[model samples]
Target: EADIYQTPRYLVIGTGKKITLECSQTMGHDKMYWYQQDPGMELHLIHYSYGVNSTEKGDLSSESTVSRIRTEHFPLTLESARPSHTSQYLCASSDNPLEQYFGPGTRLTVT
Candidate 1:
């Protein structure tokens, strides 16, 4: 089973503060991904990693950046926060399509 976790399940900050959304998985999956979601809306892929030391920006445009230095961890950071950046970010890892698992997301609200 995929065991994934995210810290600071919810966040509220001003327009200029920086933030990092943390994600970790215990299933040892090499493929990790980050997705941005909005309430009652579709999800958009923002970043992904194939394995350790390998990372790629996803199809959607985002102000956040991610790193994959370990097989079980992928953390994303934003240099500066803005009201337009508020949303839910989900972390996921998978060994295969059928084995994919998602972390409980981090909800961010920038004022």
Candidate 2:
């Protein structure tokens, strides 16, 4: 199993609220990524990092941001969330050709 985790398993919040989705891994991987996915859909990469102090936005445009400070931690933040931002946030990490492992995910619903 992957050593990654995400908090709140689920979240329901009002519009315009600031929220942070936590992600962490214990696999000692230097690469981590955050992907946004809706039900029965393909995941869209929104943020990723190569290692500590190295972060970058992914191919997809997103209102969320991420940071990689500690080797085992990568957290995503939304400055002001909206209904449009409601989706499942999946965290994953990989070291090489091995498949990426995903967390249970944080399902956010804005109302």
Candidate 3:
């Protein structure tokens, strides 16, 4: 089973609402990442953190932001949700480059 976990598995809200998606890994993995995905589109790596105080923006542009103050936690925040924000957000943690543990994705919808 995956060691990663994401809270509020699903969310729905009106436009302009602020939201945070929480992801945590208990395996003590130092590498964590977040990806944005659509039902039929490709996975886009939006953010990643190598360890505490180490964060880098991925090739994909995103309105959301993430922080990694603690090695086990990487939370993503959206200042203002919009209709276009509706999508699936996936979190992952890895100890090695070849394998990763994925969390139960959070599905967000901004009506």
Candidate 4:
């Protein structure tokens, strides 16, 4: 099993509501990432962090933001979500040469 975890595997909310997607890892990896994906679609990198105090936006554009204060924790937050934001948020981490391991994901919907 992968070491990462994401909360509220599914969520439905109204527009303009603040929401947070939790992500954590137990592998003590310094690299963490957040990706957005539609059902059965390819993953798009939304956010990533190299280590504590080092957060960078990914190649994809996203309204959500992430933070990496602790090596094992990286959380994504949306100050106000919209229907367009509806998608699956996946969390992943890598130690060295190994490929990233993914979390189950949070399926968020804003109506």
Candidate 5:
């Protein structure tokens, strides 16, 4: 498994707050994914990429955006956060499609 990390592991912000959830890995995987999950719910894929500058939206629709400028970093940003955006954001990267390493996850609360 790759060494993956997410900054500000837990966060609480007021409505309309702008926030960025950072994800990074040291193994330099070329494929990355972002998934969101509400407490006790199944994860929903919101974004993914195969490589730098190759971004694609996932199964779940989201108000957030992601960028992949480097192979090791993938950041998700909510330009104007709202209460409905509260959830756990998970970042995963893989060298093999069948196996992926995941970050600890960012638990966000928009109040």
Candidate 6:
């Protein structure tokens, strides 16, 4: 039952607030992914890492950033939150690209 976990499942903050979405996995997967989704919309890849200290920006452009300092942790940060940044952020990990384990997801709201 190894799984990915996200903290602060729901968040509400004012514009210009700085926040970090925490994500971690117990399965020790080598590949990690971050995706952003709006309600009723498709998920967009924002960032990914192949291994520790190896990171890359994803297909969809994002203002947020991520770091892969450890095998189990992948956190996304928004320096200054904005209304346009309000969305659901998902964290996923997998040994292979075809199969990914996703976290519960962090729903963010910026006023």
Residue-by-residue lDDT tens digits, candidate 5, 1-111? 559999889999999888999999999899999999899999999999999999999999999999999999999999999999999999999999689898999999999
Model 1 lDDT per residue over 1-111, tens place: 458999889999999998999999999898999999999899999999999999999999998999998898899999999999999999999998786699999999999
Residues 1-111, model 4: lDDT tens digits: 988999989999999999999999999999999999998999999999989999999999999988888999999999999999999999999988669999999999999
Can you list the residue pairs that collide in candidate 1?
A: none
RMSD in Å for candidate 3, one decimal?
A: 0.8
Clashing pairs in 2: none
**Superposition error at 60 for model 5 (Å):** 0.4
Q: What is the TM-score of each candidate against the true structure?
A: 0.96, 0.96, 0.97, 0.97, 0.97, 0.96
Runs of candidate 1 exceeding 4 Å displacement: none
Worst 10 residues of 5 by lDDT: 1-10
Per residue, candidate 3 scores C-alpha lDDT tens digits across 16-105 of 999999999999999999999998888899999999999889889999999999999999999999999899999999989999889999
- The C-alpha stretches of model 2 lying farther than 4 A from their native spots are none
Model 4, position 44, has a per-residue lDDT of 98
Each candidate: what lDDT?
0.93, 0.92, 0.94, 0.94, 0.94, 0.94
TM-score of 2: 0.96
Error of 6 at 98 (Å): 3.1
lDDT of model number 3: 0.94
Kindly provide the TM-score of model 4 when superposed on the true structure, using C-alpha atoms: 0.97
Q: lDDT, candidate 1, residue 106?
A: 97
- lDDT string for model 2 (8-111, tens) is 79999999999999998989999999999998999999998999999999989998888888989999999999999999999999888578988989999999
Deviation (Å) of 42 in candidate 6: 0.5
Q: Would you give me the overall lDDT of model 6?
A: 0.94
Candidate 4 local lDDT, residue 45: 98
Better of 2 and 6 by lDDT: 6
